[model samples]
Target: MRFQLLGPLSIAEGEDAVVLKPSKPSSLLAALLIHPGSVVSTGYLLRALWDEDQPATARAALQSCVLRLRRLFTKYGVTGSLIEAVPGGYRMNADADTLDLVRFRTLVRAADGAADAESELYRLKEALTLWQGPLLANVPSPMLHRDEVPGLTEERLRALERACDIELALGRCRQVLVDVWEAARRHPGRERFSEQLIEALYRTGRQSEALSEYRSVKGRLEEELGIDPGPGLQRLELAILRGDDLGPAAVDQAVPLPGRAPLALAEGPARPALAAAPAPADTPAAALPSAPASVPPVPLPVLPARLPVPPVPSFTGRAAERAAINASLTARDPGAATVVVLSGAPGIGKTALALQTAHDCQEGFPGGVFILAMTRPDGSSVTPAEAMADLPAPGTAAGRILLVLDDVTGADQVRPLLPAAAGGAAVVTSRRGLAGLVATHGGTVHRLSTLEPEESLELLAATLGPARVNAEPAAARELARICGHFPLSLRIAAARLLTRPGLRIDDCVAWLAEDLPARLSLADDPRMSVPHVFGGALHRLEPRWQEAFRRLGDQLGEHEGLLLSSGTLGGSAEAEEALERLADAGLLEEGPPGPYRIHQLLKIYARRHAREWNRSRTATAPH
Candidate 1:
């Protein structure tokens, strides 16, 4: 029996083929087969099966679907039990002989290790052929299609790129024209394919066509992405226009394949010849062409412009905040630079929002989007001078640049790093309100608060899947509320539930409510703990401010919405200062007028600390 996942979901034995009926079973089978021989977690399978609208009895329904898949396999004469029920989920047993995906990967690996160009090209073409159409085209699972299909498609395209490169190297430019042309057309934004298509056209004696292809791609990029072609594509066009030697040296210099070594082409006048290969490791240095001063030094390759920010796959909400930041970053005003400060409490998704905004507004900043960590991993602050060293030198990149100063400890730390050029932009994210930075630099300070109820639910659905969340809508909402609607806390809660597939939403809520801010941590990742995040913020406060925070927490217990007047903290001028300080640190939210309120989770955390402080004070008394 053979499982086919390179295209649509199907099983075949010899000439007989069968596609599992019903979308749920097909989705289940695809999920299991994707990770053959490994357990597909029950939580993942549930999400794949139902997406957002899971029934209450999803677990039982999942079991029924698995049983149906097994029976279908048996009805089609698939030998043995291909599907195995593991402890937490199901696993499909398959190998290169039984699965098309596995076979495709095997061929690609073989190509990677091939000694000759012909052998490598053959294996790559074979692997490419296995991709009949869009991956799992008939599989009706939005979760699978969204997450799994794109990566698989990317693998096929990379393999195709490698095969076409080899064909060009072997002086078979005419043969590769069709594949390269189709690929460039299909994926216009992918510059690598466009680069290859141009080279193939130029080598085929169609220089005008090659130049025209470059113009088309340039126009498309400017129209869609609002950016010019990358340095490599521009260089390739220049080389063609100069009518320079479009040899292996020029071609390789113009467009280098990532993760691929320079190809050694067959010797021919029409075909561009590769530079001389280095002598074998065993050869004596005296036999080489190097004689110290006589040997020309190799120039360092220029690195591409890229933002170091991590990908936020499950980022959700803050639509208004995102729009505000986008406008501030992308606003074109040559007279004034843009500096947007995102200030909020720890774990409120400050960095996530900043990075997402950077990615969204990347087109406006053509020079590059650079992210500098203003705080080190150990919680020490990064000095302004040290942070400035990470950015491009003054007036280097042609276009305007955007710098992201993340986790800033003070306004002073970011002052030196701010872009001096007009039209430049920077985004600063920190726990403290950095009002001084905004006051000095004249930028917008977006003080983030907890996410709205619907936004929090949307975040939970994105991470935990809509099926499980929608199954117990009330419990899910309560869970979000218990998490204080903070992005970090909600994410931690979602992680806990995801790791424990059998834990019910209401039961998890009960467990969290019993010992929140503490139970809100994942044991594996200490970074994901709410207590750790809150503790860090508390640690940053002075002793007096810390005491004020604890006392406020103790006094505000069980009544989260009760606004606190200055009288609650002795009604003195000093008391008002303390409240303002706490609010600035994001430990308190200043309500209408002079009163303030604390988040429910923060209140619980603060109360826990306040009791500890009181007990210690009693024990240390002279009595």
Candidate 2:
């Protein structure tokens, strides 16, 4: 089964479509899409759903989610339980391609070790082809933002490296000059790109231009890091001086340069001794944007300022769920239909599913997927219009375009990012329900949930190794129980096991039970944790609302997952207003109707602080 989590969550078995439930259920499906091939425990799932305040019937509700997913899979002729139950939770039994990040990583890995020059070039091209857009497009989950943001940056760098490699290997150094020039302009502080440009210049017989490029990079490096060029690069410059041909020679190729020792390449062609070829004045360097003469090595200008790097989220499990999501999205709708939302709580894998879905639909969206990540400043999500403004302007004839806007908690923030026409759909992800927005835009809202038991077990097996999983199913189940079926938690636990090869199943279970908080604490990384990211909202809340938040945090599961609602901490009207405020800030997630939960990690952090407040209250109480 090919799972699609790149866009709207969907699963497809060959040509068939898997139907997912709407709104809340769709959110659950997105959560399941994150892990792809691992088990997600029920506790984690419930906490994701309720944001720490699980319902009395959360178990049954989760079961219903599993049933709905299974039925959808069955309708599409999927024989096995795509959403299956395991000892303590569920898993989506599928492959990595169900998630775009996994597929992208796979291609990247392939490109990394590519041998033959032609094959390496081809592999790089293939790897680049997979990037329709940013991973998960617009949807930004803590689980995804933490992992995907870093991955995206790394992938971009990799793409640049491959492009440079191809240009050098193909002896098309002249062609890449303009591109590298632009890249340097865009990323002024990056010395690697500058190095590539210099190498390309050297290869093109422009020794002076190459030296100029080097000087620029050197200046910038000195300005930024207070250092000189590294040895490899200094060696390259020395090689150039010794009349060494800078053509596509491997690093080890022994080539004599003026005063330097002959460097050797493992399999490089011999370079001709010397040619007094004049620098091509009309070359790309000449075409580059001119600067005042005083600006030495202008091409290597220092960056204006450091760009803000958002947190990268890491998601675990949900291979099958992602496949189902992809299958459903790729499946043709009767009419010219578009617009799918992968909605779920933070860290529940909405973005992960969305990414897989987008990847699956790459062939469908020739215009390529445009992504706008919605970030919150303080407590409020950035508006849609603000996000949309950053996207490349759509062409007059927008054909087969997939636009993604992620983490849109408020309607206003989401409204601007949407495409003007309904011809091509925009896939949006959010913690808050967007029923009104969906109706306004003629879009489909799909809720995502956590994994099923079988899916969970499969994940455990994959993470812990099948041999160990098979021997201790009961232990796995108990571990899953403590994990709460959350993909992130499950992966953390599984990763711990993997790292400690000799870790026993029962020992893991015992550790979880004896120090559940500590075990869960280990799962908390500020970069990947939803609560940490969303805590900005708490800082912006009113004092009364903040107090109410603390109470809600302390009494999460026992209080029907109160979210400034239900008057558990305050009056109904006060609760309602607070809930709205929190939702707008992306701090609180809106569930089915009256239900609400904080983002999973946020909830834990919030509760921790809340408990501290409670202790303070006890101390302050009068006898």
Candidate 3:
């Protein structure tokens, strides 16, 4: 049986075609063929088929589609169980030789293992023959189509680049002249293609054109990426200028860009496409193999310029915290991969602080200030691998990058994206203190807290005019206290004041001070409410850590709900772990004198939950 995923979706046994009905189920089958031997998640399929607007009966509909696909395969072939259900989703089982994608990759790997240029070139040409047209061309799915197509294209591109390398190795520069030159011109940042083009131009008695190409490439790299050409590129330019004895094989033995990436067998797992490099005109068969003319240059698009998430509109007061982040991340440390973790409770302005700091840090990190918002809309987290892949591939200037990871859920989620060299900096904001990050490296943790009294006032004035705040000095002070000096609450209070023009500061304070619910409610916005904002952080905690949070909510000392001890918890180790977890999560704070404490408003919320736990336990008690 032969299955094709290189272009469209086709299945055949010998010469007989196995026709497939073009419906949703057939589309599902086509999608499965792209990632054969891998588990395709149900959620991924739902998004691929219907995009984000999934129906209520989406799972049932998807299952029915899968069963239909299974029946179709069963009817078509005696091949047992092509598609089967797995724990999380479905997997399509197929031999490597049966799928074109698998066969193409196998051929490329074989080329990489070949001992000589002739063998390598033959294998590469054979691999290129597998691509009939645009991959998955018939599928009407934006999710799978967009996500999977580019990777296949890149793989073909890599094979072309390798083929050119082999042709140059066998001293057949003229054969690939027009094709490789057009490729280098169309695709910048790829020094390998440029190197081949330069060598070919020089060998054909166009030394000036070769030198001109080098200058053009150098200027483009600096202008587009703020990077210098690699050392090998510089050396080539120097050799060309001085008329050094250069050979065609120099292009093949040359180093890749950045001079840091190893000459590995493969570039991670991505498969980038290549522009067709056709044979040059008037070239002798002895110098270059006879091939079709080069395909016209198709401009490869550059990655879009990253526009970072804008800072909060009413951002105010974090002088000390801002300085701390600046000192840790954007300081003049030449080759140190530093990390700074900003830990605090929910709605405490960790994100605001980190963002504001990044805005002021543009000069130091000329490479770029990239932010990856770590939390999802459902209050869950993006997997570490996905987050890592989403980040722009590090460039030559990766050393000067100031990567801001906002609202991180866990340390493991970011481990893959951490700077490999000690030349970059990362600013991580999370409810849980990522102690593992700093403990493993020379990073620091800045435990953020509620704004100081004066800072809180400044925030109010920043939001509402200074004239209004000055007019009601006493009321303004009272309101700041009532809002617990928390940034989110303060902003909400300010938002409310702006919305209701006739409302007074004193009236606002009194209304809020009326009851616990009133005190917590700064505005009608769900994100503004004290409980809702704090609940996001608390909801992520384990049951045991949550209990520990409840127990430590009230005032410290004798009158507190539960004493801080192993006797209250299960054992000494259990109590210690619980305390550490709460402290790390920023639920436990230091009291005025020195015992563990929580925010005044958060304390009330926690006590309520603790009482609920006790009540539920009492109600469900066995007779």
Clash pairs detected, candidate 1: none
Per-model TM-score on C-alpha atoms: 0.57, 0.48, 0.48
- Expressed as tens digits, the lDDT of each residue in 36-122 for candidate 3 is 789999898888777788899989999999887778667666557778799988898766678878888898888776654455666
Q: CA shift at 96, candidate 2, in angstroms?
A: 18
Regions of candidate 1 where Cα sits further than 4 Å from its true position: 1-303, 307-311, 420-422, 591-593, 617-623
* lDDT of candidate 3 at residue 118, scale 0 to 100: 57
**Model 3 CA deviation exceeding 4 Å by range:** 1-304, 308-312, 396-399, 420-422, 517-524, 553-573, 590-594, 612-623
Ranking 1 against 2 by lDDT, winner: 1
Q: Give the true-structure RMSD of model 1.
A: 18.4
TM-score of 3: 0.48
Candidate number of the best TM-score: 1
lDDT of each: 0.75, 0.56, 0.67
Off by over 4 Å in 2: 1-337, 376-392, 396-398, 420-422, 512-526, 530-546, 555-565, 579-605, 612-623
